[model samples]
Target: MSSTTQTPEATVAVVGGRLVTPDSVIEGGVRIDGQEIAEVGDIDADAETVIDADGQLVLPGLVDLHGDDIEQHLQPRSGARMDASMALASADRANVAAGITTKFHAISFELDEETDRSPELAATMTDAIVDATDLLVDHRLHARCEVTQKRCVDAVLDVLDNGDADLVSVMSHIPGKGQFRDMAAFRSYYENSSNHTAEEAQEMIEERMSIPMETIRDRINRILDRAHERGVVTASHDDENPREVERLAESGVDITEYPITLETAQRASEVGMTTAMGAPNLVRGESQWGNLATIDGIEEGVVDTLVADYHPPSLLAAVFVETGESLPERVKRVSAAPADAAGFTERGRIQPDKRADLIVVDPEPTPTVTEAVVAGQPVYRADATTGESQ
Candidate 1:
């Protein structure tokens, strides 16, 4: 799903469930008119469609703040990429089944020819997502603009100017440093995924690492200037220290994604920037990259929102794992808080006049996603025994 540009207009009645919204919970039914939630009450009202949400929990559809899985689908392997449309459809299906109603497909547009290089491929993939918006659930582009790739930046700007891009993030994946700055780790990552031999991966890493940090900073500033001019929401990636957090705050970046330390997250919070951590980090009880755990940020009261990041199912599962907080309190970590941070006023809550993005989960020993409604249209439903979209 590339865009959330369309919504349905029919009325739907979802009854016999506990409604979980931004501000309140009701043991009743929710009414949806096309895409916007028309009402929430206990009256067993009937509409064109009626869902039997008996003994279930109804809440807002999961809103993923950031993710790179879409790109993974587009290019599953280095050389064995799938058709763009088919990849998108499959990814969207996977996300919907995992309870995400709104998804931000993080597509990296970095033009290069080394282990990670492609201009035509990036354009083709992004265009495919933009063009296929109507056929999927609420979808939007979260362009991970790599500053090192100048040509890729140009392509991304063209797409942004054409109103094809929704959310834009300034990313710098320098060869030997930052997110994968360690030469050994970088080589391992390349060798594990691509057609590169271990020797070739080392050589590529050495070649890229030789570039000065000043050059990297300059490229980032250029991208930031262009991004700010377009009125796009800008975010800093993988910030690991207080200095990095301060630098990003000074640049007027309002969102901090994946801060690597608790101090960094605290600094971001003090400056009023929203801190986003991966939900998987909480579920796994540790950061996969050995960075500061998101649970730490939450404990310190510094983390504001949760993103699905790489795995869609982690969002719902993480809520259950959260200790000490009530289900309603834990929900703010993913639902209302992220919506406010992303500046989406119409979503993230169950309220009058809000978009009707909701899911019905049967709260068994293990919760089950029973029905999912997007913009008042029933998009997914599980059978009594078969987990299928009805």
Candidate 2:
């Protein structure tokens, strides 16, 4: 008879801190073994590493259900580029420092080769993500597939079909119609904020906005069919109207990312699609694009997850800023809600058998992350430097 030897589980007991489990906050300790949480009681046990939380609030590590923070890493400017591996490394470290254990790095696949949005670059980035994550926090690819990019959809979908894509978003950006109907308003975004000349802005928009809306929507349906078949989550980006929300729901989209208006947000909620708002919007005190305030959406009970958008630390910062009635309840907006939205059952909660991804916060109005543990390993320590620099 052949027998196999079982591996011994490594355990660490975290005691004396305020433990924030999924169900409730306990003023006690937790025990973790290897990559899973072991206990949550007062059992005296030795640990390889002991974190003295010292009355700090212990919560699950933040889950960024949506964002494009990594895009800056790959492409620092419209024309400038960097090494894929280096960019991923930098972005990954920034994300971990922000207490993000799970990240969905939004990469836009623009159809036109001249647009600088390349499938080749995305594939390279995805490969780097798989390789670099061996010793780092969990990072995944979220391709913001502009439905208008008819030529690139096939290539982008190929990545998804091959398991290269983690989250696929279907978005349509047409000028003088849909989200860009207000040409004057849209002009301000490209002209004033981006500092693009009228001709340059028009050309770029013309290149992206050239595709027909009907064709793009039809293509979205096709991609959704494939995504559903693969069990990959689908999200509708920048929903502007009720009809769009209804259509996305019919297409089996569960996440509605950045609904531009309040009506669209409400419609998405009515349809039971989890709404995602930008964390930077919350941190900056308002939306840069002049959309519905995330705070308002949260108040209306329409917002479900907080995405980092452009800055990873904003995810943790937003939680502190929104603790109006209760801190634990507000923290859940960043932790549990986004984790549930992303369909990650193990990492979001501080429960036994769950992945030991947790953080210790100072419990102040502008709380700082004291420690960050991912899969039972310390990835960040505030005393080691709190914010991103370099």
Candidate 3:
């Protein structure tokens, strides 16, 4: 009798790792046939290219809904701006290194905030995000409209009308409200942000406080309306209380990001709106503004998504922090949850027929991304070819 030999035909196989799926954790491997996953558990390890992930966790690539790190990359120092393409490329490397497969860059539009970088950068930044193909990770535009300024609203609406922005969020940062509820901290923060004198910062804060809520709401509604008509997702930032959450929910805001209080987050959840908190808040165990701690929302089951905010690494670090939840559930906070919140339906979980966007994580003394694969192609790989991290 003649026996025929079987050949492994997968493009790449990530083996010997605990796979964090959407609903469960499996002690097996995954195979990428091409751009999509072919097998989930007990995958054939003899593929053309095998990545041994023994003693590590194989997680879905992180989907960062809101990250301000792009701005920092654009302007590394006060009054010093780098080339837009170069800055975006740098941010892309940093994000993929942290296992972020999809990144929503937050572009703030404000008036009279010269040090916040020119509000004109909004159009330039949005164009860069849409046109750049050199970026390794998937990039989207998050238009952050500061409602106190009508020009800011106009700019964001134009982006929406042009179908350039993927997400839209309305925020009003008056000193006595929202995240700046602590007026002292607010003044101190403004003073420290630039060379502005205490008086100049106070003047700026007071100027914002003078804008009536009626005016702010009108500007906010216009942007929200345009965004909705364009089928773009909307969010309200730094909600202060349940009443405020209710108001935003009534306005058809689909998300509440960085709710300042636990009650606010709970109200958002109760009203069927998705709640997102910053990953830095969870990693730090408290809010910099002394607002509701992110753990409070996690313990209460209110937080539906965790964004990168100003720090991308915090997202990966948070999954290993032991939050009393299974690894699969905790992994969803950064991957599945944010991906769903951002309306990215195709590539958040590790499953057959899904896009092969995955990360090999070594969670020993800390969680570090060793290899990142997007669309079945390796984008980054650390020099761990010899040790157990291979």
Candidate 4:
């Protein structure tokens, strides 16, 4: 939980760590000059600070394209609420401690009859995330716009127009499709999460199904257009089939966030779309909702990026899961691939001239983040007694 601000003359050299580059792992370490990586080979010159990472893995800081764990911080329990800014600050501490230096806070614009996720609350949350500039890690907004909720479209558009949205993802949580494709699962989720009865959930599902397909399509296109005009990255959530993938590709979505099936993910990859899966899925070895297993998708070479999703710490552990790829390649799935999917060309790799966003990890007894540096600033360090950061 200790941090250090980087001065203009501040320089750091991490020596003896296993440096994970985009292509290879170097036993030698790296040198950080100012806010950029100065060298990736042997460092023979003197430096202001030197961290001996002798038996650790030194890799680029994780870039999470989508993480919604902040919601738990905002409302730790039912009927309990905390200030959005305070919650965001707490989330930032957790994210940085988890070795995630760059995080896109996924804020939902979906209005629920039984929840406080109204349009007004969404705007307030977006502003809170935007105003939280004092945080140590880089925080961006990923506006999850629900196309089924026509009333929320204008609010999402406002976020895009005002430049509060760094990335916009279109999602439709209507029961019978997307994440809740199985009616049994949908009923269970609605009854458990919203305290809705079976009859009420069915009625709600029918009402959502009554919405015209053209209306949903038009609203999604409008939001995507606005996001594209503003040069923001856009994504489509829970693609169900190849036709949905084609539609998203045609709508100019750069990334596919969570395909429900392996075929759909493969189709997205075949169509040249960046396919993203949740890190928790890989770590758990299965999808939570009986969807396509992310490990299988990785083995099939269809999944491109691994996001933290609802668990911020899963990104680091997912890199060590036994995928058929090399260590460098697996690390790229959580780091470089996510950064590239989010249109961040400067980070996600430890190379010369790139931003000095790095993490020192102890990979032996357990994969844990020992230290995390973002843009040459030391943001988090693990406690020696508890072996935990923050």
Task: Give RMSD to native, each candidate.
Answer: 2.4, 4.3, 5.8, 2.2
Question: Which ranges in model 2 have alpha carbons more than 4 Å from their true place?
Answer: 1-8, 77-80, 111-115, 177-181, 192-196, 207-210, 323-325, 363-365, 384-390
Query: Higher lDDT: candidate 2 or 4?
Result: 4
TM-score quality measure for candidate 4: 0.95
Residue 250 Cα positional deviation in candidate 3, in Å, after optimal superposition: 1.2
Per-candidate clash tally: 8, 0, 1, 0
Over 1-390, each residue of candidate 3 has an lDDT whose tens digit, in order, gives 011112234388898998999988779999998778899998777777888887688999999989999988998897888988888889988998899988899888876555754468777888788878845688889999988877888889889999988899999988878888888877888788765779998897878988988888889889989999999999999999999989889999999999998888988999999999988999999998899888889999998889999999999998877679888889998998888888887888999998889999988766788988887877778866553322
Q: Mind giving the per-residue lDDT tens digits that candidate 1 earns over 1-390?
A: 444443455678888888876566678888877778788876547788899888688878888879778766776777666888888898888887777877878777875455344767767767777778554477777777776666767777776787666677777665544567565677777787556788877776665666677876776676667667877677878877788778877877878899877898999898878899999999999988777898888888888888999888888887788567777777777777777776786887788788887888876666667788877778888884765667
Backbone steric clashes in candidate 1, count: 8
Query: To one decimal, what is the Cα RMSD in angstroms of model 2 from the true structure?
Result: 4.3
CA error at residue 32 for candidate 2, angstroms: 0.3
* lDDT (0 to 1) per candidate: 0.76, 0.76, 0.85, 0.87
* Of candidates 3 and 1, the better by TM-score: 3
Candidate 1 backbone collisions, by pair = 8-34, 9-34, 10-34, 34-375, 35-375, 112-117, 176-181, 177-181
- The candidate that wins on TM-score is 4
Indicate the residue-level lDDT of 369 in model 3: 88
**TM-scores of the models, in the order given:** 0.91, 0.90, 0.94, 0.95
